[model samples]
Target: MGKIFTVLLVIVGFVYAKPEIVIEDPWVRAVPPTAKNTALFMVIKNVGDDPDTLIGVKTDISKMVSIHKTVNQNGVMKMVHVDKLTIPPNSKVELKPGGFHIMIMGLKRGLKIGENVKFTLIFEKSGRIILEAPVKMK
Candidate 1:
């Protein structure tokens, strides 16, 4: 009976397990009026034991929002679309310039500095996280 009880406890714990995600320093890049695209940068930290994957992003500022990564191909830098970005348990992933970032394309208007933009980040395990990121330069 003791063994069975222990197994039940383990099962219960597994059922309740979830990823604790924290977003820090989230900001959108300021763009000119003629610019049609921009990017969002932030630090994604997972404090829980379970890992989570960032699968998609939704924003009203643009119709096209997707994950992208900067890569060097034959000594030339380029940005490539990525389907997902995984954040490991107890670790943090920094989305900065020249690295992983969220590409906001088809901008409806220029993103001015100090303007806040709402974004819904979809995670595989953590679900949708809504945040307002301020627009900044660099």
Candidate 2:
């Protein structure tokens, strides 16, 4: 009887787990003191059963923020601004350097190492995610 009760408790806990999208490895690269642009990288995972779109990004430390993707066309590497990035259900999307990343332009000030930068990621279905990315020099 005790074993059955323990199993029931475990099942109940799993059923009541939080259901939402997850953000993984959210960090920012500390830019040079004279640099004017920097990027943030992260992996977004949709743990829920529904798809979600990252519609907008807002930050106080930059003059402009946008989703950007780098592509090689005709042997020329170009960076283009993307409007929205979608995260499929039960899948993960990685935003890393040299690929899809969050571009921050016109930095108000240079990012110092170990500083926390706050960002608000607006999603279409999962709502706004408030997160802070630690600045690293990697």
RMSD of each: 1.6, 6.7
**Stretches > 4 Å off in candidate 2:** 1-19
lDDT of 2 at 69: 96
Highest lDDT: give the candidate number: 1
Tens-digit per-residue lDDT, 28-115, candidate 2:
9898899999999999999976678999999999999999998889989999989999888788999988899999999999888998
Q: What are the Cα lDDT values of the candidates?
A: 0.94, 0.90
How far residue 129's Cα lies from its native spot in candidate 1, in Å, is 0.8
* Clash number for candidate 1: 0
- Candidate 1: C-alpha RMSD to true structure equals 1.6
Cα error, residue 110 of model 2, in Å, equals 1.2
Residue pairs that clash (backbone atoms under 3 angstroms), model 1: none
Which 10 consecutive residues of model 1 have the lowest summed lDDT? Answer: 10-19
Give per-residue CA lDDT, model 1, range 1-138, as digits (tens). 999999999999898867899999999999888999999999999999889999999999987999999988999999998999999989999999899999999998787799899999999998999999999987
lDDT of 1: 0.94
